[model samples]
Target chain A: LVDALTDRELTRISCGSAFREHFGAPYTVVHRRDLHGALLEACRKREEITLHTSKELASFGETAGRVLARFADGSEYEGAAMIGADGLRSRVREIIIGDGTPRPIGHVSYRGVVPLDQVKDRSHFDDMVIWIGPNLHFVQYRLRGGTVMNNVATVASERFERGERRDYGGPDELDEVFSHTTPHVREMLGYVGKDKNWVLHDREPRSGWTRGNVTLLGDAAHPTVQYLAQGACMAIEDAVVLSGKLKEAGGEINAALLAYEKERYLRTARVTITSRIFGDIIHCRGGARDLRNHLLAQRTPETFWEVDWLYRGIKA
Target chain B: LVDALTDRELTRISCGSAFREHFGAPYTVVHRRDLHGALLEACRKREEITLHTSKELASFGETAGRVLARFADGSEYEGAAMIGADGLRSRVREIIIGDGTPRPIGHVSYRGVVPLDQVKDRSHFDDMVIWIGPNLHFVQYRLRGGTVMNNVATVASERFERGERRDYGGPDELDEVFSHTTPHVREMLGYVGKDKNWVLHDREPRSGWTRGNVTLLGDAAHPTVQYLAQGACMAIEDAVVLSGKLKEAGGEINAALLAYEKERYLRTARVTITSRIFGDIIHCRGGARDLRNHLLAQRTPETFWEVDWLYRGIKA
Candidate 1:
């Protein structure tokens, strides 16, 4: 989606894992000395994605109804408006809404990415399969052109007491969630390493999805856990809806942005709530699981078959 | 699998809704008659699958193999071999592998069969999915041509010494296994009615898979908690291997039966042990779940993927 509606090219960055895993190749195998040049070239080609790097707004300036985002480098671009996809620690989110502290979700998610063929019995599973057991749940899905499969496992916890960020989410925490999963699942997780990732499940909807011509999308506007497999789906939806409103609203940046949030907030909020509802249903009380099973036995295929056409034909 | 081998054409007893669920609809509706008649007709089809229901063998009629069965109609069919697939309480198993009564593996399972549609979010799960959480574990699977899903939830219990059918399985006894499951799971019991199947996890491999022509199969031969979704799989595998061995010996029933037991005993024993390993992984100390997850992360897809394949591909 980023490839559309912009003249700016993209640059990708990582320790080669994401490159091989997500896009199946790295931007280049050049030395660190050439990284800046590589990034600039990537920006030219509109193909840059970064992790393990620092990003900050070098300058936030306003033009005729346009917000300018100047990075640390000399790169600057003109746009009708800037969209912030920055996440939970979103600087724009903090600057615009003034809510600096992130609320604890009382949940933690452990995530990994493995190749698709690595799994056993693909005949019964799907491109995206979820195992929602009692207090914890996990999702496995294909990505990177189906060359790799990603896994995200979460566990419900009432304990979100503050602790050192570095110390809190480590191997011990990831292990805790798997303890309740099956041995089959335990065997599945045998490959996660420090090279993997874990994230806390605590973020609120941004108070304002937009400021002037600048707006937020994806995790910045409405952060959510992967419970529903709707994170990327929402971001894509946001892009489409925003572009539609922007093109239709014409010259009024203010009206367009308001309309975008109005058109999107309640809908996204509903999804956010629904996602959480689904999570609770999967991880709720013991009897709830029973009722869920009974209802599934009684209701699933009928309900499940319709999902493909639901959400107004949104395809993931 | 059950339908392909059944005498469905002769017997047609639809289970109102009781015991039919755990077996699913395919096993229920696919089989033309009630379990009682189906068993009888099944026995007639190859005259091979005998209906031992209500048949009690009084003495061991020695034919190289001592028979442990007695017919209800006062008939005897002693052969060179015998088996005890009578379930958790097997007279054959008892006589052949004499020892103290079976001991619970510090766990007991809650079993229920409910209308498939009754389970809410049923589509969100698979016909077979295992949920593992600290101190709690449950498995859900669809049966009867995707009509109903059977559920078996397990939890550790030091004792069930209460005056609730210490020797007989009953609904009240079944309810306790679900005490810690989700509430939705508990509500499904509305369909549980008078017939409930909760059994202690008195699972141990048979010390002897054969006592001459008398060989055991299914739960009687080796009772297993549904930790790995391999119980029914093993039974089916048993039939295949036993039949193969019998065929290989050119209908020399004695040699074939012995080989069948020999081949199956080791395989079944290994599966049972792995499931117990899984049980320990899921239902052990709170700290253990964490350790299990950590161990999984350290493993690569190559490491666990082949192991899963080996498990699924194991024959006989």
Candidate 2:
């Protein structure tokens, strides 16, 4: 995957070099926006798909066994079923589920990419380095074909509760949070510009996604924190599995949607929960941190391949 | 309350006459549709309200500190806040909360009114009698100023699950369920026609409702089982308390909504849970049914008035 994503100068790092065969695919780097744009373009090329821009949902209901979606301008569209892929603050999810809000996990993340020219040294360009500590972690990865390095710093926020928004406090505050770290880590923080931080929100696993003729997909169905970087991947998987289920069900749209839900629910839930646990392990304090590091050092090729369950698809 | 509602011939009943002073307000009967229409007219008269029909939610979002509602026709309406009172399959509830379908408790109810003249005798014309048996219960009440008697028969169904529509099996199935019940009860069940049966669906208590600038009200927020008869009453109380809180919040819409939810959550949840318990107690079988009957027979006027928790409201 690393060779496929970018064949730029590779970083020989402590983690990847230590367990190259076990890792199966070397960690690849890609810009988030570029990946999103590529997916959008692929979707646009599909013959059956017509992408509508700036179209919003007024309300939705069922009439004569068809899903009737009414827009604000008094126009309506009818279909056998409707798939809600409306991201985290999903309106279609709201229509089917009623009201449940995403919970804040008291963590805020600052993300930005620094141009390679600005860095004093670029020797770590191929290394995806994760600096773990008490209630905080910093990850630096190559992006833009290794010309720029992406830096993400996650810290435990003090004031924000489960439902409250985080108040961003500029780059100086970012510097203060990582003051106890090594000098090189402190210098990495200097590269992050203001206006790049955001509060991370997620939800517990839910049993429901399909209701009658309406169903949910992607973040509208299950949204998780960015700890695993599998949010977009899971959504893409949902689209594929859902389409396959719809075709498999013959002509019953609701039944097909339900089948899709049954197939994808546990897999997505596992990803959501595993990502949380993975973050907790990396952001440990005191004795737990030593234990986590010890476990990482002890990773055999066989044990590391345990993540094959994640990289590979679930059993039929 | 009875005199205020209508000037019809009233039933002098055992329960009401037995504890006249303790009951507080005399029970009044009004057609559900008539009462709903009255409420609608009152809402229509309010100058602050504008009634829009056929407007459905296409999608919704938050922008510039406002809740943006987009209809299916591609038009948008922005508000400082939104209150979702869309009832049962509420579109607004779906937007604020994701998908959690209501659970069915395996019961179907057949309801209809029989004119007093249809019966050979009208001796129990004003009396409200509940005949309970194993897995079934029959309720007979006077309606339309004692000119008619309404019979409701609730029976357990084997075929349907929660979120599935109830199949109306006509009077023969109703007769089969109540064959072992009392002769009078069996005769009363004959009065209900084939078309009035409905499946009862409800949800367990949920935690999330208010999110940012949007919230839910009444059935859209907390939909309870009909066993309590408090569904409409609780919805009415929600409206009153929500408006009061909104006024009290001064200018903070989210705070007012949070306050309204806080005041109502526990009270409504209690009603929802208690109603389910009451239904279970009423629909007991074998030894449980005998025990329940014995307890009902032993009830004194004081014991009957013990429903002050329900009638007078829970202690503060």
Candidate 3:
């Protein structure tokens, strides 16, 4: 990716919703020292680095917290401070402040990899398909160099709760979401014929995610629902903003941490609200699907203009 | 108003949504001689002339259509070939288009009026009060010389079908919409109480409002959903743009009329769609109401940002 970017001589970087996934020589993908080495190397060249990982918090500490890591090592890490980029269930999250908890928002999610090679029709390579109804959505996007399609489906359900299934499932549940999709989208997904399922968990905005010198970051500090496609972008911003405040602290890590936490609360709260509001497009069901679609048809891919600033970063 | 403007030497007219009600006054407000004298006087004296009216559609088609207008000698005009600035749903609309019907969107609206003296809080006047919940909305403002408080209530009711109830309503239904309102807003409404109800009708976009020397103007040509509060603003814009195009046509009224029609379609369609999207705030029923309020609370008044150009009028 750096080589491709360097080939173009681009300086500043702000990520869009998707990035191309590349597969090459094993060493080219990750040179033995593993993902951390690759991440650090990217930063070394002034290339903005972003990583998307999902995890949960089992338990908390004042300055540092434990994280449920899903890297190849399967080992947990504890440090003086943690960037809770591990998402909603960040172990760092549970440690920073004990007041927050993920509440069951009564929705289920479905995702799948639809192979583009089998699709035969390549007309949709640069296009996205969003099937929205009152309370449900089925989205399909080209992935894996546009060779494979990534699909995510969501529905508003009354049954699911926090203590239930930890491992979200596959295929059949997603078929139900697609049952009523438009013929064009349904036909495209039909070409792939299978999918995966998961539950969507969301928590309300929190006041603080740090205690003393230790701090929480990204999804650890503030978790957002998926409606805005801002999850990864927000975490990346957390890292950038944290670095900025830390640079200004003059070794007063605690002060820097305070600044970071305070600066972020309002913005994260907004994304939290925006994501949930956008969830309407996903969790819409039955007749809601039609209303949502009609509304979508009316929208110009810029309906949620208020949240644009978040994804665009701090405007330099 | 024209004389006041002339005496003041005003160069521009920019009426925000709050300043929108007095565009083209009904016969009850301005005598015809006074009105024409004012217009002719302005035409001869002023560099520019502008008007703002929110509900003038009550006179949709006075120019191209016949109207039962009684003169001082008890005479009437039919298929009137004069200017139709009467606004949307003009009696002229019925005559020109032969009483075309308004489609029903299955929505009912209630408006409340409060005297400024009755309001205990004035701080909110800087921003409009929008208490929106599932399937209903309570909109309040300090309008008309800032002496009176204006409140508009909107809701989507399955019970209110097209052509079923066109009569203005009273307080019972208004109270029903507020049954789920937050206590704070309910108390506010109780303070102002009811003034009257409005029959919020629906209509699809029309292809053309002119064919010959006569042309439809304002609401007579296009009507809007009040969600974006651009209904009157659009009419005023239409009046201005149509006038501009007419003058530019240089005696080719037919060409100018066609040009105005073509120019207004896309902008109005955008406004139409945006209005409905915004109407989503009031049309939501049940859980959607809570969702809408949550969304609105999270929204910045910068919601105005989305329609800046529309309110400002289309660019060349």
Candidate 4:
């Protein structure tokens, strides 16, 4: 990581070493589409699992022994149990929890990918670099076997601060926010896609993930902001734990779902809250920003004490 | 520091090394009365200073060149400038800023000092220990050259949570809050004074400390909660910097005050906000608490990087 204004190196850690030391695996970064395709291929090979597409869930209802899911096309499916693995804005969560829309957290992100040879600057190309500044940060990393460079620039939306939600995070706002950054960071902003932007939103974590034979999973269960880059990892962890609980339940679906919810609730909620706090720390202005820079600059790159609980995964 | 429930050691640092290495002085703990007396004696020795007693400030006003202060006893004094070193409830601040009372952040503390031999248990007497638990913490340290022990117990008030502020933090609440803590921590709670308790308050940091010939200082400028134990320290820092600015400005009082305010505003504001954040960290519950404990346990006691910006004092 580097300070976007002064270009001072804050701290650096070897992701490979951090993962290898804790989990006995090298830290690997892959594109989301590639990972999704791989998972889909693996599931297609399974004999009992069937994949369905173009079926938008409208709502779900559960009885003591079974679940019924209704789709937007006036079709219905009955199953022994239902798992809502839908992403954010899951109809399952809306029906069960009754909370409205996810809260827009006032941050706007522009992201894009380009071939490595097309990039003019190579200073931070070999490593994942985050240039942090007041109310703004730029992240850069290599993807697709190091052939493509992905760039993301996120800034606190002035429009959102002024209480205007729609038509915010535009290309003009992106340029205006990055205009004051260092020359290197400013030049890199050219790589970010201006046509589209992500307005980040997250739900305040709640506990009732399981009701009867129906349960929520992944982003539907606990949608979090992307500050920690752990939202997808958390969903994967949820799947592992939930599958283990199901296998151990001896055909009792409700008991297994409750046990899974009990184990996963606190861990995911901490991630959701901690991610928001991390955003505040990185995007803080004035005195708080100065304090953050001073403290972060003093940290040793090799020390992993602060992140041990996170990277070590859940305790058995 | 230790976890109150399981009696697990978190992390420790030598105060002597921390202060000596950073500030070229030993970390010294003294009673508030003794410190106040020493400051009063030093002021008394100065020929330019006069001490007054039993005088309550009613209001103050200032012209471009002069400041006039009025006391509730029907007396008025005029001077070239005014400094509101009048602490948390300064009338000078009331006249200048008109911001109302400080905000009570939902915590209550009871503190008292007793002779060293009054307590039966002495396992943690030699060290300044803080037993951190969910929404509550107990602190103990030796004072007055180790002849007496100062005990402070702080807990998040249920009454405050229920929106009934008055008559809260009573002795009964104290007993009920510490009931679930370990026996050692519970026993130490007996030493806390039951007659009165302090409801913690701190202001959201603001920047307008100076207005013309009059300015606020100390707690009046940036009152803070006691979580970081830096309230008095920030005040002393303000005094030092203000004096330096005045001496540098020669006869320009307004210029000196403005410069002093500029220099001290960000530093003191950081302290005020950081203290509140520290309160949340120590009082965190459930998953966040678990994460804190796990991370804290992995830290080597001698690593002072996190506090280098704080304990090292301000830059020249």
Maximum-DockQ candidate: 4
Residue B250 accuracy (lDDT) in model 3: 86
How much is the lDDT of residue B268 in candidate 2? 75
Per-residue accuracy of model 3 over A1-316 as CA lDDT, tens digit each: 0011012111112122322111111111111234456566777787444433453344434433232333443535444454555567766666556655686566666666656666645544555555554345656667545566666656554323223343332354445555655555556555443433556666667666766666777777777777777666667677788899888887777788888877776677777767786675445443333333344444443243443455345632
* Tens digit per residue, CA lDDT, model 4, B92-211: 788888789988988999998989889788988788899988778999999988999999999887787667768776778778878878999998998988788888898867777788
Instruction: List the candidate 2 regions with Cα displacement exceeding 4 Å.
Output: A1-27, A160-173, B1-316
| Top lDDT model | 4
- Order the candidates by DockQ, highest first: 4, 3, 1, 2
Q: What range of 10 consecutive residues in model 1 chain A has the weakest lDDT sum?
A: A1-10
TM-score of chain B of 3: 0.67
Off by over 4 Å in 3: A1-37, A40-86, A91-107, A114-116, A126-149, A153-177, A180-184, A190-195, A266-311, A314-316, B1-190, B194-305, B308-316
Q: Which of the predicted structures, 1 or 4, would earn the higher TM-score when compared with the native?
A: 4
Q: Which lDDT tens digits does candidate 4 get at residues A55-120?
A: 999877777697889999999999999888888888788887778899898999999899999899
Which digits, one per residue and each the tens of the lDDT, describe model 2 over residues A38-85?
Answer: 878988899977777666788998876599898767778888889989
TM-score, model 1, chain B versus true chain B: 0.67
User: How high is each candidate's interface RMSD, in Å?
Assistant: 16.1, 19.6, 9.9, 4.2
Compose the digit string of candidate 1's lDDT tens values, residues B1-316. 0011111121122323532342333321222234446656766888456454566545454444445445657776755556566766767666666644665655556566778767775542443445555445655666666777676655555344332335433444345555654555555444444543455564555446566667778777766765655666677688788878877898466678778877776566656656766676665432233334434445442343423432444443
Can you tell me the DockQ of model 4?
Answer: 0.19
User: After superposition, which runs of candidate 4 have C-alpha atoms over 4 Å from their true positions?
Assistant: A1-35, A45-223, A236-273, A282-316, B16-23, B158-170
What RMSD does model 1 have?
17.3
**Shift of residue A221 alpha carbon in model 1, Å:** 1.2
Residue A56 error, candidate 2, Å? 2.4
DockQ-wise, the better of 2 and 4 is 4
